[model samples]
Target chain A: MGVKSTASNNATIFCNSKRFFRKLKEQKYLYMMVIPGIIWMLIFNYIPMYGIIIAFKDYNIISSFFEAPWAGLKHFSDFFKDDWFPIIMKNTVGISLLKLVFGFPLPIIFALFLNEIRNSTFKRTVQTISYLPHFLSWVVLGGIMITWLSESGMINELLVNMGILDKPVAFLGEPKYFWWIATISDIWKGLGWNSIIYLAAISGVDVELYESAIVDGAGRFRRMWSITLPSISGTIAILFILAVSGLLNSNFDQILVLRNSLNASSSEVIDIFVYRMGIQSARFSYATAVGLFKSVIALMLLLLANWVTRKLTGKSLF
Target chain B: MRRKFLARRTKGEVVFDIVNTIIMIVICFMMLYPVWYTLVNSLNDGTDAMLGGIYWWPRVFSLDSYKAVFADSKIFRAFGVSFFRTIIGTVVHVFFTSMVAYGLSKRYLMGRKYFMAMGTVTLFFSGGLIPTFLLYRSLGLLDRFVVYIIPAMFNFYNLLIFQAFFREIPDALEESAKIDGANDFYIFFKIIIPLSKPVLATIALFTGVYHWNDYFAGVIFINNPDLQPIQTFLYRVIAETTSVHMLQNMPAGIRTTSVTSHTIRLATMIVTTAPVICVYPFLQKYFVKGMLLGSIKG
Candidate 1:
């Protein structure tokens, strides 16, 4: 019986191998098409993931990557003990939370209001104008922001003229206002573009629902509240989950362009900190450890948000 | 029926529409004013404009800043770099990604699930900054033009979009080509590509814009000043060179110059942004459609 079972198992494995080889040969051209992308993935994506082991090592420029001495948890501990830890965490979380609070709902509200516009030309014009900022790189927009918020610029000039301020103030130069500036500018840039998803979702709603609500004596606001809002709640929920997961991302491009020596205290986030440490200061291992830390926390946040949303709304990204 | 529905609009509805329209107008102004203000300043005489209070239009219209920006060899080189990168990057990215997507679209293709799983993992995590920097360094991509093209070759999200679109193409089309003795490459380059023009344009525009706007590559990978793109050049001009300290420390005599760096800065901003703004109106519908195709689940 043992001999017979062994022979059967060997025969099954041989058959599977033969079939796999035949399948591979048949799809050789398809494999040729796909292999380049797979190679790119291995080199650019997977290799870096493997290289993340340096986060545990005491890596330096002088030493080869593999030759670097292992110092388990040292870099991470050092990062935790670093004095900039609290400040960076605060700024990262603070700016992100501010953006989430102000930036998230404005788009939905904007879309809702834009939907109510009866004139197609007027609506199209507003959308076109609004989305213009989104296409501009943060560098360009940051440059514009700097110009407009300078003491001699438009915002200050307007305020001084309107008697809102006795003097022109450099808004970006003030550390206290960095969070607000970042949050507001982020919303400004994304408001129209972000609303596109919500608007698409709203458009998909059954028009009969709105007609029925109107027939039931529901007013415009009532119809909006009951029909429009509920119809697009899935999109809202998904976006909210994404926002929560991305709480650590402080819009690194915006921060890089906007941050200066003056607002460095308020502007420094994990991403910038990592860039500074790794590239500027050449503390590669420490920066890698910090980046890994952030990535793990971000992954955790995404999973947590996905799980919670699934529990609450029966919807999840995964 | 719609006219009847419109006629039934309540007093509250009328008020809402009025308020909403006003708010939207304000929003539009808010969106447009910064760019307009920059344009006015760029076209204005630099020294005179610095005296402030020039809001709506240029107080002294002058093209000196634009002339200066154009004459500068460095800015011209940067523009060339930007133009080439956008063109080449978009073409390569579209062709390569869509080709791969074509292969993956076929369920019968061997190891399709594994390839997908590999891509899906990258969407969630990465090797972070230092390792990527080191990897690029070792790969001899640093300070090279190909760095822009190679590392950015495949975006997994874009691949998924292409795959989705490719799957919708009728299988009979490919089968007929196969029976005609046309190889996969021939079919892909001829039939598949021509039929996929809309998605191609959508992806091309996205990739082109990305290549045009990316400044981080200049900041990190490329050290050669000549290789820096226009956006990075603008970043240096606007962020680093025009710091408050420099502006404050500038000798009073320099202000007398017809084109100070300030106006030049504004001019450069407008020049860099002009292409985007010009194409925006025409490409706006495609962008909207692309955004929907990307985000909306069937």
Candidate 2:
């Protein structure tokens, strides 16, 4: 019996190997098509992984990577001990939370409101105009915002004219107002564009559900509340999961352009911090450690969010 | 009673329509006001713009800003660089992304699951900016146009959308092509390519917009001013508002002499954004459809 079983297992292994080789030969062209992509990824994505070792070493441009002496945990400790660490953390988390609270819901609300409009023309116009800002680079938009918010700019002039204030408020120059302004500007830029997904999801909701509700004496509001919202609940959940995953991402480009020395206290996020320290200061190792730290945290949060969604809602990002 | 109910319903509908129109118009103004402000301000006389006199209309309309922008040889060169880079970068990005996406779309493809897992891992985790910079440097790609194209070639999300679209194509098409002894490449180009025009067009527009608007990569990778794209050039104009040297060699008495320092900033912005805005309307239908299709699902 043992000899027979051994022979059967060996035969199975041989068969699998033969099938694999045959499959490889048959799909050789497909494999060839994937070569450039794989090579690009390996060169640009994978090779950079070796540089992560610099986080542990006292890396310097003059010394070879291998010759750089290891200083395990020193960079990490230095980052934690830095005077600006808390400020940066506070700004990053503060801005992220504000975006989550304000920017996330803006699109959802806009979509819901837009869904109620019966006029297709108006809907498309609103969508087009709203989405225009998203296409404009932050560099340009930043200039626009500065012009509008400057002491002599439109907003201040309007406010003063309305007798809302005796003097013009320096909106961008003040630290206290910077975060709020950033959040509002972000919402303004993305509200329409971000809502496109939700609108699509709303459109995907079965028309029959609305018809049945109407037959049951449901008003427009009731039908929307019961039918439209529930139909796109899955999409909302998925987007929420995605948003939670990137709780650390505060949009570096937006902040970088919007930032000034006066508002740096409120505007600096992890990405901007890493840019300033790593790229500007040339503390490559320390910056990598901080960035790696953020990426790891974000990944862990993503997995946790996915796990929780799977457990509670029976849906996962995967 | 029936007449009364019909009248009430019609009245409610009328009210809703009016309210909706008003709200939409207000939102449109809010959306467009900033852009309009920039445009009008750019065209206004420099001193008038500085005094915040121009709002809904240009106080003293002038083509000086436009002339100022075109007068500079650097702006023209940068525009050419941007156009070339966008064309090459977008084409390469779409081709590689679609090819890989097509390969991965097949269920029977070996190592599909592993490849997918690897792709997903990249979506959430990267080796950080420092490492990526070092990697690019080591490859002798830094400061090259290839640096702009290679790193961002395969956006995994876009690839997934293409893969999904390819998977939806009827299998019988490939089966019949196979029976005719058509090779995979032949089938991909001859059959699949023709069928996938919507997605191809969508990806092209999307990639084009991304590459055109990108200045971050240019700032980090390209040290030479000559190689800088339009966005980077505009960024410099904004960041260093006082530097007339950047705009030197313009037609005499064009933008350099007339536009206020602040209006110059706005003018540069308007110049950079106008091309994108012009291209948008033509592509809006496909662009929105593509975004919806790509984003609505996983």
- For every prediction, compared with the true complex, DockQ reads 0.76, 0.56
User: Candidate 1 chain A, which ten residues in sequence have the lowest lDDT sum?
Assistant: A1-10
Score residue B9 of candidate 2 by CA lDDT: 62
Segments of candidate 2 deviating more than 4 angstroms: A1-19, A63-67, A215-218, A308-314, B1-16, B240-257
Per-residue lDDT of A292 in model 2? 81
Stretches off by above 4 angstroms in model 1 are: A1-15, B242-256
Each model's TM-score, in the order given?
0.96, 0.92
The sequence of per-residue lDDT tens digits that candidate 2 reaches over residues A233-316 is: 777778888888888987877787677776777877889888888877888889988888888889888888888888877767
The TM-score obtained by model 1 is 0.96
The candidate that achieves the highest TM-score relative to the unseen native structure: 1
Of the candidates shown, which would achieve the greatest lDDT relative to the real structure?
1
Instruction: Give fnat for candidate 2.
Output: 0.58
Clashing pairs in 1: none
lDDT of 2 by residue, B1-298 (tens): 3344345565666787678678778878888889998899888887666677577899888777777677678878888888988899999888889998888787777888887777776666778888888777767888888888778788778888898789889999999999999988898899998999889999999899888888888777889888899888777665433223223323344444457556666777888889889988778888888887787445
